[model samples]
Target: MAISIQIDRVSREYGPVKALDDVTLDIRAGEFFTLLGSSGCGKSSLLKLIGGFDRQTSGRVAFDGKDVGNLPANRRPVNTVFQSLALFPHMSVAQNVGYGLRLRGLSGSTLETRISGALDLVELSGFGQRDVNLLSGGQRQRVALARALVMEPGILLLDEPLTGLDERLRQQMRDEFGRLHKRTGATFILVTHNQDEALSLSDRMAVMHRGRIEQVDAPARFFEAPANAFVARFVGIDTLLRPERIVATGNHAEATIAGQTLPVRVEGPADLAASVVAIRPDRLFLAPQGMPPALTLMVVGTTFRGLHRDLKLAFSDGQTLVIAIEADADIGQLSAGQQVSVGLKPDAAVLISSAGLPPA
Candidate 1:
């Protein structure tokens, strides 16, 4: 059965350093969740607390409302697939997959059946007898996944399992993870520093920084309406303009920037000084020849990006914003210091706080 997790005011201290600082989070049963952040962000520390490999110094770690902080790793209904994979290279793939079952006294046809089933689940149906040492990187990754799934734990923890794989294999394994999550209705908690991995695999994800959660929400929410400026930058919304003046009107606003006014979207009452305009690159375009332009800025630079070209435009005050245009689009005449008209789609410019907000 899948298990729900409750981490209430969890704090993990190592001497003077606090790896996890009063963190509180709830994960639903059978949902795919990701803990995302850069290194040393307490994501791995929190995972250790959940897996029972390490206990919290203060606060409670619960599974389905029952405290499990005192339980050892083996006693908890959890299994982890670490980045190292830790496969027994001397053993055959089948032996590695069935090692846990054998330790629990499972043998004969029963053990073989479980091993075969696990291998089949990871699409490694007939390679059981092959030596694990000779397998390719991706195949070895599958073997590790098979070993973890074979345990049938209620909660599966993936700790950077795709860390060392090449880009193509990483993508392949990422899709495999999504497929496995659906095949087995276990609560999946993934810890990854890679944003692409977290954004693609998680049903919902938490962004952690400096031993605290910055924000928690679905992937699209992060792109559409980030919690604050830090999250806006993290999710690829790089253009944040501090408007010289702003006029409020319900959920919409008009912000004056570079001597021109542009329509901006807002969630609630916005403080003119505290809020900044977040411009999404996808929402920017070249001004229509017959229509009035929102703002006319000087082109500072351009970079070729295969399918698209990134144009860097600078305001009068030297503030720069990058917008992508089609590679084949006619803009060869545009050069540095040349003035070009740009248009912003309605509600494309979001008014967000310049400061970081508390995690939700």
Candidate 2:
């Protein structure tokens, strides 16, 4: 069964500091939603509130339209897969997966069948008799997942489950989780600091900062329409012009840096003279004769990144800009210590606010 969850102005305080500050969010039924942020940013605190492991200091948590703030962990129809896996050292994979079922007073062939089905869902069929210690890291992870699934919780919370896995295994587990979500149709709330993982895996995610919800949107929209400056930098926008260098001109603006002034697109109110300009690397182009240059930069460094060439340029003021050029581009002749004319399309430049906005 799938369930929707709501966090209404939830806050968690530890004496003097507040871990979560008047945070509000909604998770749709059967969606794979993620809470993404750096450490001590209240992402984990909010997750704990949802899992019923920790109570909020104020506000409400509701599941499937019922107030669940008072519900104990055992009474909630939710299960959490922790980063540690927490598998039994002496138990076989089968026994570990069936641990919850046995605790719930389920036994006989029905319990065995359920355990087998759970293991098969994670693609670990026929490995039930193997000792957990003998299983590989990925296999053990699958077993841990199997244990959680066997309980058939309405919602599943995964707390950095892949953080301990190697690169290859992490990717494999990502695919496995995607498959499991599609198969089960249960709401999944995942916590992670890996932006790539959050973008690739989630249907929609909430980006948190300093115990506040910075932005909540689909990965594409979050990248394209960052609510503020923090998200712009965190989401891979490489070129940021200091507010002092930005001169407003209605919907468009100009950035003057390193003795070079370039045209930019302005967003929101014009009252902010200290607002910054964020530009994605892919948006920059090498201007030829027909097209005029928007910004001129001195090439400081270059890195060959297989599919593309990463060019590092510096403004006259010593600030840096990174541009991604296609591998086959004419930049083949370009090098460091060279002055080049760069062009930025109107929509490529975004004026992001210096601070995050509350969810609208």
Candidate 3:
């Protein structure tokens, strides 16, 4: 069975810089959790704290109800697969994988059995005697994973573990890791800045920003119902519109551009004095006939983007929106400075609080 890792109000500082601030979360047994953020968001620091590589300035880290806040890295029930594979070129695959067991004084058939089992688990069963240098990139990653799994730690912490692999190799390794997780049944904590990796690999994820957790939820829920404006804009590419520009009348809210009022959807704050609306590029529709009663927009520019063309429009009132359309769409008639109206489903707009800057 896997042990749960609990982080309670953990905060860390490096002299004058606050790396993490009052972060609290729980990783359920056998759960694949990811700490995702851009560079310098303190994800790596938090991972180190969990692994006991770094101490938190305040609060506690507990594993299975035991406060292991002051425990040393090697003494904790966790193993880390770092960005670098850190394999030994001087040793064969078997030796490298069995290094920990040998250090713990296991020898003879016991050590061989353990190493062989781990190798088999990682799908490198017959390659134990091969030189580490001769393996492919994906194979090396598997070897690293096998080395960590050999110890049977309560949890596995991976820090940017897939950063160096090529795209195809990364995908292959991700699938392998998923399969290994199910086989090992150990709690996995992954830290990465790559959004797609987090979405694809983690059962649940926490988005860290500027030393604090912005949001934590399952990948699908987090994407569909973002907590705030920052999360909405950060998770995907979007345009943020002004609150006042959205004139609410009856069940519909409309924004006028190029002498046309485009219908939009909004929820909550029916009496909102200041609100922002976020629209995904794909949500906006381009029509052959202009709907003057609903919307009006002028095509400022369009850029070809392989599978899709990016349409840039500027409203008469000076607001800009982007629409991503099929590359083969008959957009030849749409040119720079052309006048057209963009329509949207009244229920498609996502309203967010304007407590921060518009999406960039």
Best by TM-score: 1
Candidate 1, overall lDDT? 0.89
Q: What clash pairs does model 3 have?
A: 258-316, 261-294, 262-294
- TM for candidate 2 is 0.90
lDDT of 2 by residue, 119-212 (tens): 8899999988999998888998999999998898899999999999999999999988888889889999999998878998899999999899
**For residues 155-253, could you state the per-residue lDDT of candidate 3 as single tens digits?**
999989899999998988888878888988999999999998899989999999899998899997664556556776778746666644567776577
lDDT of 2: 0.85
Q: Total clashing residue pairs per candidate? A: 0, 1, 3
Each candidate's TM vs. the true structure?
0.94, 0.90, 0.88
lDDT of 1 by residue, 197-264 (tens): 99999999998887888788988888778777877887788888878898887877888887778888
Judged by lDDT, which candidate is best?
Answer: 1
Task: For model 1, give the 10-residue run with minimal summed lDDT.
Answer: 351-360
TM accuracy, model 1? 0.94
Model 2 CA RMSD to the hidden true structure, in angstroms: 3.4
Flag regions of model 2 displaced more than 4 Å.
243-269, 327-337, 356-360
lDDT of 1 at 235: 79
lDDT rank order: 1, 2, 3
- With candidate 2 superimposed using the best TM-score fit, by how many Å does residue 233's alpha carbon deviate from the native? 1.5
